[model samples]
Target: MDFHVLELFSGIGGMHYAFRSAAVPGKVIAAMDINTNANAVYAHNFPTTSVCNNNIQSLTPEKIEKLNVNMILMSPPCQPHTRVGNRLDVDDNRSDGLQHICNLLPLCQGVQYILMENVKGFEISKAHDQFLDALRLAGYQWREFILCPTQFGIPNSRRRYYCLARKKEFCFDGGHILDDIPIEFRMGVIDGMMISNLLLPDNLIGPECYLPDKILSKRVWLMDIVTAEARKTMCFTKAYTYYSEGTGSIYCPLNKKEMDIVFAKVKELELSEESEALRLELLKSLKLRYFTPREIARLMSFPNTFEFPTETTNRQKYRFLGNSINVHVVGVLIKILCS
Candidate 1:
């Protein structure tokens, strides 16, 4: 059966792409977001779909009902639930969008399926409670998951919270947290997944990706460095490239022995200007660099057909990608949810 979908908080159409990747027959009636750059990217890629630049809170039950959509896919603002944030949740002004959606649920009776993605901490929030209450009041049965892309045989470690709800009978009996990726939903080879498989040809990795000497000398210790052969990477945030520690992993194009030598010298260095200079030089030898946006997109399981418009800046690319979902993982979830 074909589904009419309304995507809220759509960033570069990740949910739309994932929906298509699921091989589910669907039409995205409207893709909505406030970010102009993201909307531009979505429009560029999905010329046939309507991309709306509007705040989620402004979406009324009347407006949504007019679309006659059965499925609602959303990735709401996660800042309020992030560990680093104040954890204001429903109290945070940023959460107004999701809270508004909850208010609309009861009035929009035609909506049968809802899928949402957010940071891992969301399940515990007051916003989550409100959402659950709304779903229950609307006679929807839901399942929640705390999944990572690694579970889907992707090398990246983006542990996130997902909720799949439907108005139909809950055929798949389960508790709130899905502990495993059901065999039916599994894709890719778990044993063979590596960062190397997602990397671009060396020629495409430009010198522009190189880290500055200042960051190398001061922030090297905090960087989560990984080689191409490695199977995992830290979760990349929008702050990637702008921040070093905890922002994301850096690419290290050096062998184990070379990395060992460089780190050993770094450990021995005193807190002096001379030591900082030596640290910079040592790190420079490693040729450490940020993963280009394209590499991150690949790691996120975006298809090769995905492309940023020529006018989109590198920073914009990283920001949109960081905000987006892992298409492959979400695709599997969509198949399970829609089935």
Candidate 2:
């Protein structure tokens, strides 16, 4: 039977892409988020589906029931649980958004499956305990794994925690017993054979961001994958960010080849007067110009056919991408769940 999914905090439908990858007869019947720009992008990309822009706190069980959703996939805000953000009081309003979902869990009477994705640090949070309690009280069976995207053949190394839960009848016998599992489950992507198997040709454009000159100059001496016996390169996040910045006007490492590439691209694009002005201002800081939203969307593994509303600003686009789930990672989880 075809499953129907309801995506909560569905920024640009990353979970939807995962469902597609599973190829299990299923559809994303509804998606909800509070950001207008994100909602706009989701709508543009998924024109036939219903996209709600209201805060999830206002949603009613009756409304959800109407969609006949069999699965719930959520990626709640990481800010409340993140180390970098304001470590607000447990009762702080910032966490209220997440609390609302926990409260709504019991109300989702018909949902047979639930999947949540979040930062690796969520395992220690009180909010996570609360979430587990609710799932347990609901008589659901669940399992969690801390997975990195590289294991699945993606070039990125974003490590995230994924929880898979099912109603009692559908749960696997060993679902909750992860302690005895082999250490392979926790292996970083660099150790995975899949990375080499799916390695794209070197010509695939590296991230468009820029990096410092010192790092760029060092690249020449670094061994190529076939010749060099290094197990792994730098972490993807830092490398991508650094490369994107280096490619732009940030600090032109005094290297002729690198400078030529950046200057040529800048001239080729002939950015708008306003963008040029912003670029100049960014140059003053010596930090590489941030990736265009389109570039970010690509890095997140959204299809080229995916559309973003023309009305959204580049900065807003970056925020949306930053908030999105890594599509390839989600796809692997969906495959496991469906299998």
Candidate 3:
């Protein structure tokens, strides 16, 4: 049987792409997000589907059930659960949307499977507790993972929390979410997966794959360095394209000796208007440049067919990608459960 999905907080339809990539016979009947940029890209990419531009809290069970959706895919906002966030958790204004979803769970009746994703700290949050309680009340069983793309051999290090829940009758544990969380979970479960196995072929890897984004300036030294043979890069957060500090890894090709000299020179100079040009010139000499939006999308496992409108800025593209999911990694999970 084909699964029908309702994607909440469906930033750019990353989960929908994963479902298609996994060869799963399903369709996302409706998707919701408040970000117009994301919704624009999503609509351009997924022309046939119904996309909602409203807040999730305004959603109701009657409206949802009418669509004949059986599965729900969500990657709720992480700001309230992130360490840099206010730590308000369920109390945060941003979390009210998810709280509304939690409130709708039991009443939706037709939903049999759900997959929710968030940052590492979310599993320990009050929001987690509240959402789990909603699942419990709705008679759903779940398996949670604190999984990284590295585990699947993808050359990026996004370790996200995924809770795959299924209705009681669909699960062997009689709908009980497992509390015995493993310290590590690997994909390619047949022979036990390795990080080296899920890599992109060499031909597909880009030319400037090792250059750090030039925008790093003096702090360019802090960019997560990696080679093509290397198996990991840092997580690309929503701020990736616009900022270099904490967003994602840059492809810096500078050697240790050159990097040391560059940083030492930066440290020796006074960090004022006079030194700014010198620092940028120094970083430029090291061949620093941000990953093009396409490369970042490739790292996230989006297929080549995916494209953004010319009107979408590089920053906007990266923002959507940063908020998106890893297609291959998520596809594996989708197949495991729905197939």
Candidate 4:
């Protein structure tokens, strides 16, 4: 039987794409989000699925039961937990929607599987404790992971937390629990394994967007330096494109030679196609002109076919994507839960 899914905060259907890529017999029966632009894009892409354009807090358990869903997948907004905004505001309205998920858990009468994805820092929040408590009280068996995209062979180093919970009766305790799994279990699962593993090799592009030879040569050195202060580095959420403008940008403690080479590369190209086909291809692979909406979508592992509505501004698109979850990460959790 095909598993039916309900996706909450379903920005541009990244979770939908992940479910599809998993080759599982599943269908997204319903999706909900408050952002109209995101909902427009979601509805345009998923014409048949019921798109509920409303705040998640307004959704009642009875409403969700109408979908006949067997699984629920969600990535609630992370602004409250995100270091970019107010750090620990439990009262933040942006984080309020997460409470709705907790409230709705008991209403998921037929849902055998559930997954939640969010920023890594979410684990520290009191809201996370409440969420976990709800699941445990509901007799659900669960597992969580702090996963990095690079571990999954995605080239990018986006890291996020993923949780998979299932009704106790159907739970696979051995695979779902990750306390002391084998080394094989610890290995990152890349996207290519489930879908086409094709990725643009680093050399085939132009000089404009490429990391400079010096910086490339010293990547290990930079990594070592950053490792010493990873806690500080990981907290930064500046866009890569903003590095040139000196706005919200981050920098490694690279030496003058490395910095000069990196800046030279950044200055060489406009966001145009001429200076670098590789940059263009990379943008295409990631899907966007600059590192805004598309980069966020890429980090979230949304499929190339996903589209934004023409009616929506690019800025809004970027906001929605930034708040979304990495679907590939969710898909792996689902696979393990159902195995």
Candidate 5:
């Protein structure tokens, strides 16, 4: 049950949180990421752990050897392989870190299990091919999953690609190395919790742990989204607050009649025909505020005690939450492989 974890590109130590929060007995020996902001948050939450803010390409075998961890968990940068990105694949500079990790796979004597999470497009990317090739060459068997939080009953719909690889010595039953082998084969059903179930009662939730009420006071459409009977929404990205187009889900609890009435008002006010600012004001008036950092963190399955530094801004917090992994979902995956 002893799991020594090495976290690569460890944004906010999401994997580290999963490793510890799950039933598995493990500790992250070291976590590496180049983003100082994320490292700060990771350090804030896990003060005792070693968090190295450095490029992955600089992660030498000697460094891996020193940590001497038995498992690797990472969610490498997905920009290069993302649909909106340049789709540079393995040619992208960001991929260098993962490539470096791949190179170290054969050299790192203690690494036995690997769990990599990335955007859905990653499965088809050349970078994925390179990663799989490395694992195969290193004699590790892997299973691929295109999983979403909704599958486990959490409302946020973040469909990601996960590759769970185990050294041959600890391999699964020679299963399809590129398919979503049922985790249920080993781990039982993960208890389902609706988004409403996760939220603390309004009276109990701190008044200040949310966006300012005045900004979204008029936006009636921007109400509780994770309510009972309706428990789902879209993926959250770093652009969550900065760009609302496809960022993440909102808390809108509007009913069909109410939605029609709101749209009718938009048409009546001709807000769509006005300046962008005016249209935004109209939208904001619908009570559509960004999910408070704490709410988003809760949706992402970060525990109540997980907090940002006092100086961290809401925008920065949103970015961090959007980038961090869903602890509950990832915890299930780890339990499946480790338990």
Candidate 6:
């Protein structure tokens, strides 16, 4: 099966990379996104492919028909349904683009397969019901999943919602929906290592990767700190470096004995300017740091070839990656969809 994909809300071409890695006979005919920063990165990586910087709402059936793509890959704006967001569902202006795509489904032609991903809470949203209605009205059969990278032994926990749909004429190979990722897709040692085994050597990591003494002393208690030998990491968000609690995991290179000693001294001090200064001094010895954007991309299953433009800032890279999909997980699904 040759897949000519129309990628919507395409951020940094994660879906395009997944398609290439899936070992399927496919190419993205055109990718559409309104984010200028994401558009620059996408074009940097996929120079031959068309990367349109246009709003989804502006798409017409005629425009879509001209592409004649058989598969549609999209990760709509997740802000409205995210746990930290306002939970506005379909009412949020950010979701208008997704609603526009749903409305366009019945009118567009040759789109036989559709795959969408979003935050976990999206399953219960009114927009999701509207999407199902559109799929049904367009004569498609569908299966939904809430999957995490850890299920495939990747060692990072970023649970997300995924939906795969095909025209009624086609059938899913075993056809029964499992609440979990199919057992056949489960594997160990993705891209040659789990997170525990993949920690980059200090020489490869830059000085900027280390957490500042200010952040270390203030939010030390709230951080989800892990060591190089740990098998798992918390979900990393766009707020990773900007915010402390619940945003993401921090790395500590110190061994158990050294880390314990630092905490022991912290316990002896009370809350005061003098104590805070002492605490900061003690915490500095532990040598804690954040996982670099490149490291986070590795955890998200993006290939080593993936690169942000030279001009892209660290914050920009984090935001784009946080909004992107797990390439390895999606590659497996793409194979399943084509099968």
List per-candidate RMSD values in Å.
1.9, 9.4, 5.1, 9.1, 4.3, 2.5
Residue 265, candidate 4: C-alpha displacement in angstroms? 12
Model 1 per-residue lDDT at 313: 94
State the lDDT of candidate 2 residue by residue for 25-46, as single tens digits. 8899999998787888889889
Positional deviation of residue 105's Cα in model 2 after best superposition, in angstroms: 1.8
Candidate 6, position 179, lDDT? 54
Better of 3 and 4 by TM-score: 3
Local error of candidate 1 at residue 51 (angstroms): 0.4
4 or 5, greater by TM-score: 5
Per-residue lDDT of candidate 1, residues 1-339 (tens digit):
789999999989999999998888978999999999999999999999999999998888889889989999999999999767789898889999998999999999989999999999999999999999999998899989999988767889999999999988655666768856666656634567888888888888888899988888778888999997888998888989998899889998886677888888766665434556676677788889999999999989888889899999999998999889999888888888898
Cα RMSD, model 1: 1.9
Error of 1 at 3 (Å): 0.8
How many collisions between residues are there in candidate 4? Answer: 1
Q: Rate the local accuracy (lDDT) of all candidates.
A: 0.88, 0.62, 0.76, 0.62, 0.74, 0.85
Which candidate do you rate higher for TM-score, 1 or 3? 1
Query: Candidate 3 vs candidate 4: which has greater lDDT?
Result: 3
Off by over 4 Å in 5: 169-192, 199-229, 253-257, 268-285
lDDT per residue for candidate 6 within 1-339, as digits (tens), equals: 689999999999989988887888979999999999999999999999999999999898899899989999999999999767889998899999999998899997689999998998888899989998999888888888888888777768898888888885444353443456555655423543545575777898888888888788678889988877666899998888889888889888876677877888776774433557777778888888999998899988888888999999999999998889988888887876676
TM-score of each: 0.95, 0.69, 0.81, 0.70, 0.84, 0.93
Candidate 3 residue pairs in backbone clash? 153-195, 210-251, 211-251, 211-252, 212-251, 212-252, 213-289, 213-290, 214-289
Clashes of 3: 9
In candidate 1, stretches whose alpha carbon ends up further than 4 angstroms from where it belongs are: 187-191, 268-276
Model 2 stretches astray by more than 4 angstroms = 169-292
Worst 10 residues of 2 by lDDT: 223-232
Q: Using lDDT as the measure, which candidate wins?
A: 1
Worst lDDT window (10 residues) for model 5? 219-228
Estimate, for each residue in 1-339, the C-alpha lDDT of model 5 and write its tens digit. Answer: 588998989988789888876768778888999999889989999999999988888887787888878999999988888766789888888888888888888887688899999988888888888898899888887777887877766778888888888865444554443444464453433456665565545565544443344434343344433333356766888887665457775553345466556657666666446654554465544443346677778777788888888888877988788778888778878876674
Candidate 6 off by > 4 Å: 168-178, 187-193, 256-258, 270-274
